[model samples]
Target chain A: MPTHRIDLSIAGLRLALETEAPPADLGVDERYGAFLADGDGEPDIRVVCRFGEPVAPEGKPDYTAEDIWSMYAGADGSWTAVITYPSPDDAPRPPALLSIDAKWRNAVLTEKRSPGLWQSVITAGAAELLIRTRLVLHDSLVMHGAALQVGDAAVILTGHSGAGKSTQAMLWQEAVGARPLCDDRAAIRADAGRRLVYGTPWAGTAGIAVNACAPLAAIIVLEQHTENELTPLTAAEALPMLLARSFLPYWDAALVGAAMGAALNILQGVPVYRLRCLPEAAAAEMVCARLGLR
Target chain B: MIRKDGFVVRDVGGSAVIVPTGARVLDLNGLVVLNDTGRLVWDALSAERSEDELVQCLTDRYDVSPDQARADVDELLQQFADLGIIQYAGQPI
Candidate 1:
């Protein structure tokens, strides 16, 4: 198997990937093209890809199974590994660990590529973990929401499943000529004096992800309401909402603390709002008006 | 008696945060914050301690009366039990 080493620099962190006998395709999304490093710099973390049969707690693969993914909590100051044990005769996944240090977490994107092993899972897992690790190490974080850049500022809209994040993102695109960075997930970073929101390739159902970024202007937590209203949030009020919207590594206390601080800083620096309104262009206008974007 | 299973205490943003581990992993929504007294109670109960023991510890550490300590300890233990951060031995839920 021919090997290839690719260096990906995202969110100010460098990740070096070494693939052993590459698959038909490594399955890495090119939406990260803008963040590709020259490959000459040192990587913060080195990921070596290996192939093997999924081994359960016992020895061989098992047919009797329960959940698709099972997680075991890590001990003190560690990250929780995504562990899945196949029943008797089904091989269990090699135990993996997710930890506090931004670069220590490893996630497998297991997709059944061949007969026994999950090639896609390993590959895809590497892609996401790489990006996620880079974000964590940089005092930045990712959010489950829609991010848009209108003028000099980036606005992120987030909410629960039915909270109309995508609807609001499209409205921003339609009404304000704002570019939709990513409709599903957005990466936020707070550095020195500025906070930034970046677009990742992982788009939601609407498929509106891009390789773009802007200085963060505001964050709006959405709610479906009959009338339009935007409420500014204080640091204390915004903390939990930001935490809920983040991809938290709860197993690691250090990461959790760092993440909490990052969220608090973002809240203090970036204006956070709770917007309750219908899913319409007017909702977008209302938000823009509040932010003085219009 | 209540024991600290895999939970950890950290000072985060001027607040005491208890991070659970192992099978005790808490969902993001279950994130718990402790007041200064809550932190003291948590520290005293790091090992297995009965309600009376905790009440005494609280009273000795603070200037609270035994009656007030008992009330606070009872409430705190109930909450911890509900959250599964601690367990009472040989007691029905």
Candidate 2:
């Protein structure tokens, strides 16, 4: 029942992980694992990882060590962690730490070796880090691309990197006294059967960030065309397209299906439009007209 | 009138939802309910049967006269037209 703890805060949300004693039958002398639980102490997620002597990919044991981290999401939204050690001789080092700020999110993995060697460890641990981050961000505000406030409502502008997502957000803010939620990454949550999209600290090219949430009014897919036009997309057409642009990586099929189902529920209720136009205020006007805001 | 061709209906979420091969989800409540007669009418409509043809088919299959079958088919067709489930193609069957 020995345990270890790790706490994280992102976009005004706090999450913690509790590690318990590793199982006996896993065949490792050093057995330790952790369960990621919310503040209520109910085990929502679990991570059980063990490390053994560092064995090089080449059939030889190199006291130079490595670690592998695996994660699974429980039915109740908790995560079970499994960390494998290279060998029994390799002592367990401190768990990796990650911090998200206004500029960027950083992950620090500590081992017995120098900082240069941590890169591989960090790469190996990326899956776990991504899962934990996603779990933390779940049920909060999330925008399709980035979100910006227009008048009283928050507008989410989603498109490819060069599709003018940031540019449109800037134009709306400058023309209508609007503010940015986040230019790069938008936080999302579900409330009262509606998905509320919010702005995050991660801003892409616009470098605009403000913490805010709004009931998603519409989702516009951007396309740079000569003529300014807004066309509506049916739920069938929007479902697959939105799934492709979804932020979460496809690690588990069931999780992906659930996420897609949630998205379909949103699309069925919210309006989805295809905005084909040049980057200018005119495009915003077209979008507004489609949303019946104008 | 309910133009039987160029349209299809399927049950979705316990409702008879119409989906044209290249169109959006359209409701066919007036033309078809969940009852046996409504389903039979919908099945006949799928084959592009004319009103007279549908009446004859239904009269032969069910214990109904030609006149009653014709009246039911005509009423259902008008209801389908009002609900946008089908349109008048402006041609003779």
Candidate 3:
């Protein structure tokens, strides 16, 4: 079988992909465009993708099977993730697995199962899970939100689904000429005295992914409102809201502390705000003006 | 009988939050919040202390009477048990 060497450089971390099939065969292009990189010296993380779907088990569970799922844990210093899928009969089955070294620098994709678009799906799934695990170790985290660069500062808008985070990201582009870093997920890292936000290739339906980054200036929790309003969030209120919006390492018992420690560092370093506004140009203008971005 | 693994208390800024990890991540519904009193109780239970020991800790740490400390400990432990954060010894689990 033919294979392709795909290199992805998001922020400064690298992912070397050795796929049995080209990711292009599964339509992975522009979304991963910003992350395209030359296969440099030894990628930080290696993903060896093999072709195949995971096999489902043949029987139902002894007690209940309504909530079949995956989990990750850190034993001693090693990290492993077990991903179990739901079955129609709700039968229990063996799970696909992934593991990382004690240093959180290396990981192996032990198993993957995709019906057809195996390359793109498996690559994205593995990258998302593994990258998240690694990022938390270094005082950084990823969130289900939109990030935009207004002038020199990185502003993030995030909330639960239906909160118009993407809409506001688009609005900022149209109204203030702010560049969209990512309209789906943004990676925030706390390094030295600076908090930085970077774009990822995994754009939610919005299809906005820029591999750019900027100093994280403020965090905005999106709240739909009739009029534009930007309220402040003290550290007390900001910590929980940020955690609620972040991609936490809930499975890695050891990494939970890591993620929390990073979140606290972020909360202390940057100011968080709650943005309540309409999904319109005026709302974007108002937010920019409030932040002195205009 | 509380799990020696799967759960932990993390400090986000100065606030303490309880998060599940490892196998417990399969049951990721939400996290637990700890106030000062709850933190005291949690610290006491960290080493698998019995109910009587927990009641004593609360009484010694705070000005509450033994009876009140026992009542409060029961309330919090019951919540932890219900949330699968801890379990009673010899219980079916």
Candidate 4:
């Protein structure tokens, strides 16, 4: 097959993906279709995908996340990540090796040619790792939250797993006719003069992924409670929660600093609230009424 | 004792907060919020200060006596050591 090129734009971050195999044969995940963009202008991030065994970086890795992946520092200020899945089939070799420059601008994704290598790398996680790490450098990071459009602005509900993010989204859709952008992960970016919330392809179990962007209006951290309560949070209270929920590049200090700065900027511009409520439509109604979204 | 690298401390809304970066994040997953006194101690740890020096820093600034300062410093240093935030001499890296 001839070299195939596909461009994708997510949360205003454009990527030029050049693949060695045909686009169809590469088995790229279907969720990325909504993010396909015209191959125009200079891409912010470039990825060259090919099939081969990557040369492992020498010495002990700077950081290792168990057996899933290991990060090695390069002498020239670049970083290489060897991603291996914790499965019997993938145990023999790493599925993908992603190497990005210190600035995370250019990358080469070398994937092992195996039955499920592409899925593990692209769909399971490696792509998210690439986008999130690159995004931090550009004043953006992916958050584990549900984002929806509510009357011209986006409202993001964030919390850890089993914190009822999806439940609240569904209730909002039913009560206030809100449109769900992304149910699991939302790309929060500091664009121009305002903060914007974007729909990412990496949705959670809800599988709600829409290619959309909206100016962020509010961020609600959910907590399970019998009665509905909404309280505004100060910057100090909100920053830690936002940082905990964000997909920050932990392997690099500079990237972590960038991410923390972005989170602080968002907190300053957007109102953050702690929403303690039950899993019912009334909870959504209360929020919309209190926040004037209705 | 020397403060570990890869930890970024910041002031948010008049309170000090510490978050791990780089390899430190592998050990600490979340942010560590500190009170006013905790912030002072953490700042003093930026240099290689001995326990006596840290106690003197507290006693000189605060109204606490030397004996009281020593006990407070010991508690704070124990907490920091438990969290792997500070490395004492002879402690293996």
Candidate 5:
């Protein structure tokens, strides 16, 4: 049979997978039923999950594959599912892979196993997702939960979950006719001696994804209150809040420190404010006034 | 031996710095640096647990002997006192 290959590009990482055996250095752990390997002695941790024939009894739950899906975790501490499709030459069956709840750091991998090779393909896809979204705390591209825009300049709204991030984006569109750069996740990168925030495909509850890039003007942390108001957050207050909300693994001390430093860099270069307000168009007015925007 | 709210805490460079929060950065002598295990112990210490109760809790959570736990607790308390991270609320243990 000919080999089938798939190449997936996600985030900023490139992943290539082929229908061939994996390298020998990979350690196989039967307990987790996966293969683990050290990718170039870096922090790139790789785990390969493979599946075989269903061994469950009739009317009983398929314990073999389903048990693995229960263990997968994403780079941002979010849970993700793995999808697999069976080979064409084999018996007509759907992809035989287990969905595990697991998380990975910086890693790139491709694997091929026996019988149910589709399982390896599924694992490869998951690895691509991990590499793309896993924020390299030291990198110039900083990820934050905010909507960014490019008009006179770039504007960002930083807020916690349920702190009206989506609502604020809507207001920008409705009132000022601003195009959203990103509704939930904004990737801030320095380009041409200017810091710019670009929108990614990842959308929060707002379901808004904008691929626009804009020079960052101001960063506003959203605060819910009874009235519309804007206040300046000192470096001390803002640093911890930003670090806590940052989407990175807290266990990695070096990464956490690097992320803090990057956040401080952003705070120092840009004007950051605590925008407290009710969910209304007036909140946009308050923000515009603070930014000196017309 | 770190007291809750007794130690001023701040997140310094991403790591948690349990100092007197308002204390100046130059006053390094007044702060107790906590390792991973020490941070775990600090998190577990509360007014709700008596000294004996704390020792028991430590023994349950960590793989340490009772005598070792007692010694560690005593040493940590002493360190906290020296750094002013905690103070004796009432009589000494």
Candidate 6:
């Protein structure tokens, strides 16, 4: 069968998805429309999709995630990721499997059944895991945060779930008409001596994702409060908080080390703040005023 | 004794921070900051070393007396044990 390939440029990384199925049959979600790339370039990561009975790795898994995903360390120093979906019908089926080599440059994704393009490509979490793991090698990471383009720069607001990341973004959009780059995951990397944040397709609940990037102005760690307050945090003080909110590849020690290095680089370049604020426009106004955006 | 599989120590903003990797992230959810002496002991534990050897490592590098080094090593090792950062071999090395 002829190989059908779709290339994507996400967060400045090129990913090529090759499958035996025809391109039209690949049910890629519309959310990925903005990230499609020209196929003339060399991809940083390439994932080949096929239909088969996915095999589990030998021995006990090295790591398990939320009872559905598992990671196994291969004897050749590679890693394999298996993602199982919860079926409402209580029927057992083959899980999705993705095996990447030591460098994570190439991968093979296998499934017993083809649900759709999005399910095989994105929903399986195989491509995302590869993207995140490969990102650390290039000194980049994805943080669980929302970012907005406020006057030619990106301001990232990060926190744990339900810490008002989206609420604050809504306030900023309402107050200053700031365009949200992404409402859930923000990809940050250094480019030409300037720290930049890019939007990813997985935009969480706000359902906003833009294929754009802006120089990072600052990073604000959000906390809910009755009144608006912003406090400066040193890089050392901010490292742990940022790491906690990042989608780190915790299954591998070398990847984690690279991620830590990338995070440290970001900390050294960008200023960090802790914002204790209410869910209102006034809080947004204070942040804009303090940042000299208004 | 050997250091845990995924606990890595790095220098962040002039401070030594110990970060966990792999499954260790579940056990230690936060970073561990180490003082100069604590870092010295941690580096010494890269190879299997006894508590006495760790004390000797500190005393050799710093101007502290043997008794003070031993006390510091004891405290540091206890903290490492409590945090599961180090594993013992049952027999003293």
lDDT of each: 0.66, 0.50, 0.72, 0.82, 0.52, 0.82
Scored by TM-score, the top model is 4
Estimate, for each residue in A197-263, the C-alpha lDDT of model 6 and write its tens digit: 9998887888888999999988999999888899999877888888878888778878878888998
Worst 10 residues of 1 chain B by lDDT: B21-30
Candidate 4 has a TM-score of 0.93
Candidate 2, residues A77-180: lDDT per residue as tens digits? 33333334333335444443222221112222222332222222222343234433454335332334877666556666677668877677777766555566
Task: List ranges where model 2 is wrong by over 4 Å.
Answer: A1-13, A17-144, A292-294, B1-93
Question: Against the hidden true structure, what lDDT does model 5 obtain?
Answer: 0.52
* lDDT tens per residue, model 4, B33-57: 8877788889998889999999999
lDDT of 3 by residue, A34-107 (tens): 77788756787776655444443333321121243344334456655454543334444346555567766666
Query: How do these models rank on lDDT, best leading?
Result: 4, 6, 3, 1, 5, 2
Which has the better TM-score: candidate 1, or candidate 6?
6
Model 5 achieves a DockQ score of 0.05
Off by over 4 Å in 3: A1-4, A19-31, A51-99, A110-122, A278-282, B1-4, B12-14, B26-28, B48-52, B65-71
lDDT of 5 at B25: 18
Writing each residue's lDDT as its tens digit, candidate 4 over A90-152 gives 445455788988887888888776664334365556667778888887788789899999888
What is the CA-based DockQ of model 3?
0.45
Per-residue CA lDDT of candidate 5, range A257-290, in tens? 4555566676666666888889898888767766
Best-to-worst order by DockQ is: 4, 6, 3, 1, 5, 2
lDDT (Cα, 0-100) at A167 in candidate 2: 75
> Candidate 1: misplaced stretches above 4 Å?
A20-24, A29-38, A52-119, B8-19, B26-29, B33-40, B47-73, B89-93
Model 4's chain A TM-score stands at: 0.93
Q: Give all TM-scores, in the order shown.
A: 0.76, 0.49, 0.81, 0.93, 0.51, 0.89
Better of 2 and 6 by DockQ: 6
**Least lDDT summed over 10 consecutive residues: which range in candidate 1 chain A?**
A57-66
The per-model DockQ list reads 0.24, 0.02, 0.45, 0.71, 0.05, 0.52
**In terms of docking quality, how is candidate 4 classified?**
medium
Better of 1 and 4 by lDDT: 4
Between candidates 1 and 5, the lDDT winner = 1
